[model samples]
Target: MNMHSIPGRSDAEGYLFTRRAAWFAYAMTIALMLMDYIDRQVIVSLFPYMKKEWNLSDAQLGSLVSIVSLTVALGALPVALFADRVSRVRSIAAMAAVWSAATLSCMFTRSYGALLAARGMVGLGEAGYGSVGAALIASHFPNRLRGALLAGFFACASVGSVLGVLLGGVIAAKWGWQAAFGVVGIPGLVLAIAYLLVRDYKTVRLTPVLERATESSTNAARHIIKALTRPRTMLWVCIGGAAQLVVVSAVWAWMPSFLNRMHGVAPDQAAKQAALIVLCGALGSVVWGAVADRAGRRRPAGKLYAMALMSVASLGILAYAFGPGAALGGSTQFLIIAAGSFIMTCTVGPVSAIVIDVVHPAVRATGAAVLALFQNLFGLALGPVLAGALSDTFGLQAALTWTPAFALVAAGAFVLAARTYAADMGRAAEAPTETNHLPLGAARA
Candidate 1:
C-alpha cells in the first residue's frame, strides 16, 4: 500500500496513523526542532569571539541573536497560513532547508552586516516550523497524548540549546567561531531531506462558518482575523508566553558571557557551565508539562493555574539568582540559576498545547503562529536586545537581574487566561474541521 494513500482509521481512538508512523513522525519533527535551536543558539557561545574580532558592542552582539527571532515573528503568520492551506510536510522541509542553508552561509560572511542579514534569513526559515510541527503532531497522535508529546517536542529546544552552547564554545576554542556555524549547519540539511518521508494529514478544509459562499479578499481577511482572535484565551496566553520567554531568552543568550565576566571563568568553560543550566530547563519543560497535563485532567482550567504558579516561582527564583545571590559566591549563584532555569521553562510545552486547545482545528497552525508572533517578537526578540542595551548602560549582571521581573507579568496573564479557558475550549469544539472528526491518513511504515 502507498503510505500516502492509506486511509486514516476512523474510530474512537481517532489516531491519524499507526503507532509506529506517528512516533516516527514525532521523532523526526523533534529532531528538526533540535537542529533548529542548535543553529539559532550556537551564536550565543560565539559572541565573545565575534566581539573580539569585530569590536562589536553588546547591543550589536545581542542584535545578532534577536534578528532571528524578529524575522521568525514577522514571517510566522504568513508561513503558517501557507502551511495550513498547502502541505505541512513540504512546507516544513522547505523551511528546514532554508534555515540550514542560511546557517551555512554564516561561516562565509566576513563582515558583520553580511552575518546579520544571514541570521535574519535563518529566522525567516525557522518562522513557522514550531507551529506547523505542532499541528502535524496534534493531527498524528490521539488527543490524550498531545500534552506530553508536545512538551517532549519542545523540550528538544532546550536540549539543542545546551548542545549549541556547549559545542559552539568548544568548537570555537579549537577551530574558530565561523567553523562552529559550518559544523552545526550540516545536520539540518540532512534532516530536511529525511523529513520529506514524514507523514502529514491532508489539509483541513475551511468550514462555511469561516469561509462563507463568497471567499473574497474581505472574507479572507475576516477569516484570518477571526481565526486569530476568536478565543480571547489565545490573546492572554500569547502575552503571558511572550512575557515568560523574555526571561528565558535573555538568560540563554547571555549566561555564558555572564559567567565568564562575573566568575572569571574562561569562555569555553563558561559555556559548558551555562549548558548545564539549559539542560535543567529541558528537563523542567517536560516535567512541568506533564504536571500541567495531569492537573488539567481534574479541572480543565487547572493547567492555567499551574502555569501561573510556575511563572511566579520562576520570577522569585531567577530574580534572586541574578540579583542578591550574585554577591554570595559563584558556586552559590550557579546553583540558584540552575534551579531557576528548571522552573522558568514550565510553560513552554503547555503554552503551545493551550493555544492548540482553544483554536479551530482548521486554523490550528495559524492560531499557534499568533502565539509564536508574540513569543518571538515581544519575548525572544525583545529580551536579548533589551538586556544588551542595559548591559551597555548599567552592566550585564544588572540587566540579567531586572529581566526576570517580566515573569511577574506572565503570571498575571496566565491567571486571567484560566478565567476563560474552559469556555474557550467549548467554543473550539463547535468549530468543524477534518482532524476533529475524520482521519487524514493511515500509517504505511
Candidate 2:
C-alpha cells in the first residue's frame, strides 16, 4: 500500500496509513529500536564478567560504557546530515546491518581495545538509526500521533534492556561472556532483514512557498542553521534531554552492578532482576506517551508537565531504591528499583513527542539530530563516567545516591521546556507556506 497517500488530506496531516500498514510500521520500528537497545545494554550486563576477565578497574569499565556514547556523538550530526541528502530508509537499514556486525565482532575481541573498537562501530551504526529512524517516523505518522508512535518506538528500549541483561547474564553464566556477546549480537542480523522487508515511503515534498524560499542559496542554509541553533531546541537538547540521559545512562549502565554489589547476587540473578526493571520501564513508556498525547490535546503544555512528574517520581523511587533503614531487601529491592526505573522511563515517550511537535517538518531530522547529539555527548558520555568516578571516590552506594540528582535537574529543564510550548506552537502555526518543500539539506535554512 502507498502508506503516505491519504485522499483529500493536507500536508499538515501528512501520510495516512492503512491500519495494517500503521501497525506494521510500528512493529518494525519497535523491533529495530529494540535491537538497538539490546546491543547497547548487552555490554553493560557483561561488565562484571569483563572486569574480572580483563582485571580492569572501575575507571576502565566506565570508559567502556562512555566510549560508545562518545563515538555516537562524533557520528550523529554527520549521519543525520547524510540522511537528509539520501534515503532515510536505506540509511537506517544499512545502519542496522553495520551495528549488528559490529556487535557480533565483540564475541571475538580479546582485549579492552578490541572491545572498545567494536562498541564504537556499534555507535556509528546506531547514530544513523537514532536520527534517521525518528525522522522517518515523524514523516510517516500524522502530527497528532507522532508522540505516541515515538513513545512506542522508545518503549522498545525497555524490552531490549531487559532481554540484553537477562539473556546476556544467563548466557554468560552458563557458557561464558563471549557467548553472551554472541547471543545478543547475532539476532540483530535477522532484525536487519526484517527492516529490509518493510516497504519504504517516498520523501514528502514541502509546500511550494517553502520550496521557492529554500531555492535561494543563502536562504536554505540560513534557515537550516537558524532551526538548528534555535534557543528552544538547544535548551531542551542540551539541558533537558541531556540531563535525563545522564541519569538514564548511569542507571542502565551500572544498575546491574549495583544490584550485584548491594544485594550479593550472582551475575545471572542480577541480570534477571535488571531485566525486570527494564520491562517495567518499557511499559511506562507506552503509558506515559498515551497520557501525554491525550493530555497535550487538552492542554498544549501537558507533555512537559508529564515529564516533570515522571522525573519527580523517579527521584523518589531512586531514594527508595537506595534509602537507608529500609526493610526491603533481596527481591523486594529489585522490585522497588524496577518500579522506579519504569516511572522514570515514562517521561521519555512524552519528551520526544513534544520535541517533534515544536519543530518544523523540513528541519525535523536536524532537530532530532541535534537532540541526539546533546543526549549522547552530555547525557551518555558524562553520566556513567561521573557516576563511576564518584563511586570510586565515595562508595558505590553513595555514587548511586547522587545519580537521582540529575533527575531533579531534568525536572527543572522540563518545566522550562513547558515555557516554550505555546511559543513554539505559535511559530509552527505561523511558519511560511513554503517551509515544507525545501530540500533536506536546505532544512536548516
Candidate 3:
C-alpha cells in the first residue's frame, strides 16, 4: 500500500504540501544528503593513495578529511540563517552544485595544498545542507512520522559513506584515485538539477505579536538568539551529539586504515570490510531512530533515555571490540566491530528532532544549524584529526580503541538533557504558529 494515500496524524493540522508532494521532497532531500556524505567521505578510501603519492603524515591525511567538517562548521550558521529566510529548495540546489563542483575539482588537484583547498570547498557547500534539509523534510511531513523520516534521511549519510568507501577503493584500484572523485561527483550534479522539481512550502511570516520588536536590528538579533539558545535541551543535546560523533566520525574515518594495518588486508578489501560496518551503522540509525520515537510516544523524555542507554552500550561494545577483540581472530573481531557500529548511531535522528521541537517554526533551520555547527566543529572536525594525532603517537588501533570512549560523555549529556526535555517542548508548543506559508510551487506527480 502507498503510505501517502493514508492520512497521517498531522493531516488534520493541514500540512501545506500534499502527502505525495511531501514524499517527493523527502526523497530528493535524502538523495542529496546521500551525495553530500559521499563527496565528503570518498576521500577516506583514497587516503592510502594520497599518502603514498604525497608522502603525507597521518595527521595531514586526517586533515584532508577534517578540513571539510571544519569549513562546514564555520559556514553552517550563516548559510542556515540565509536558508531560513529564503527558499530552502533553491539554497539546497545551489549548495549541491557547489559541493559537486568541488568534488569534481578534486580530480584535477596535483598537490596536497590544492586538494586540501578543494576539500574545504566541499565542506563550504555542505555546511548548512543537513539543517536546511531537515527543516524542509520536517515542514512537509506530518509530525508523527518526523522521527522515522528524519532518521532515514540521515541514515543516507552512512549509506553514502559505505558507497563512497567501496567505490573509492574499487575505482582507485582499477583506474586511479582521481577517477573515484570524477565518478561520484557527476551524480550529484544530475541530482542537483533533478532537485528543482521538489515543491517547497511558502516561507512562514513572523507573527504580529513580536513583529514590531523585531523591526530593530538589535531586537531581531536578540529574538533569534533567544529562539535558538533559550532551550537547555538544545545545549545538552548539541554537546551530546557532538561527543557521540567524535566516536562515530573517528571509527568511520579510520576503519579502513585500521583493517589494513592490523590485519594486513589490502586497501580495496579493507574498504569493503569497512563499508560493511558503515552499512550496519546506517541500518542502526533507522532502527534506533524508530525505536526512540516509539519510546517517546508516551513520555517526552523517553527518546533521550533510550539514546543514553544505547550510547553507553555502544561505548562498551566498541571499546572492547577495538581493544581486546583485536586479540581475537580477524573474522571474530570484524563481527564485534560491526555490532558496535550498529549500536553507535542511535542518536542520529532524535537529536535533530529534539532541536526542532524546542525552537520556533520560523527558525527551525537555524535551530538545526546550531546542532550541525556543534556536530561539525566539535564532532566531525575534531574526530579525524584527534584520532590521527593519536595514531601518530600510539597507533591506529589505540586511536580506535580510545575514541569510542567518548560515547560515555555522550550518554551523560543525553541523560542531563532529558531532565528539561518536557518543559522545553511545552515552551515550543506555545510559540506562534506559521499559518501564512508562501508556496513556491504546486505539487506535481
Assess every candidate by TM-score: 0.83, 0.80, 0.82
Whole-model lDDT, model 1: 0.82
Residues 247-282, candidate 2, lDDT per residue (tens digit)? 777777787788777777788888887777777777
Give the alpha carbon lDDT tens digit for every residue of 1-445 in model 3: 0112222233555454577888889889999998998898888888877778888877888898899999988776556556656788898999999999999999999998999999999999987787778777877776678878976876677778888888888888898999989999999999998888987655555456444423443554465576677889999999999999998889999988888888988888888888998889888987999999999999989889999999999989999999999889999999999999998989887898898888766566446656777888899899999999998999889988898889989999999999999998898888786432111110000
Relative to the true structure, how large is the alpha-carbon lDDT of every model? Answer: 0.82, 0.70, 0.81
In lDDT terms, which candidate is top?
1
Which regions of candidate 2 deviate over 4 angstroms? 1-30, 87-90, 131-154, 190-223, 228-238, 290-306, 325-328, 437-445
lDDT of 1 by residue, 320-374 (tens): 9999998889999899999999999899879888988898876664455567678
Q: After superposition, how far is residue 222 of candidate 3 from its true place, in Å?
A: 4.3
Candidate 1 lowest-lDDT run of ten: 436-445
Task: Compare candidates 2 and 3 on TM-score and give the better one.
Answer: 3
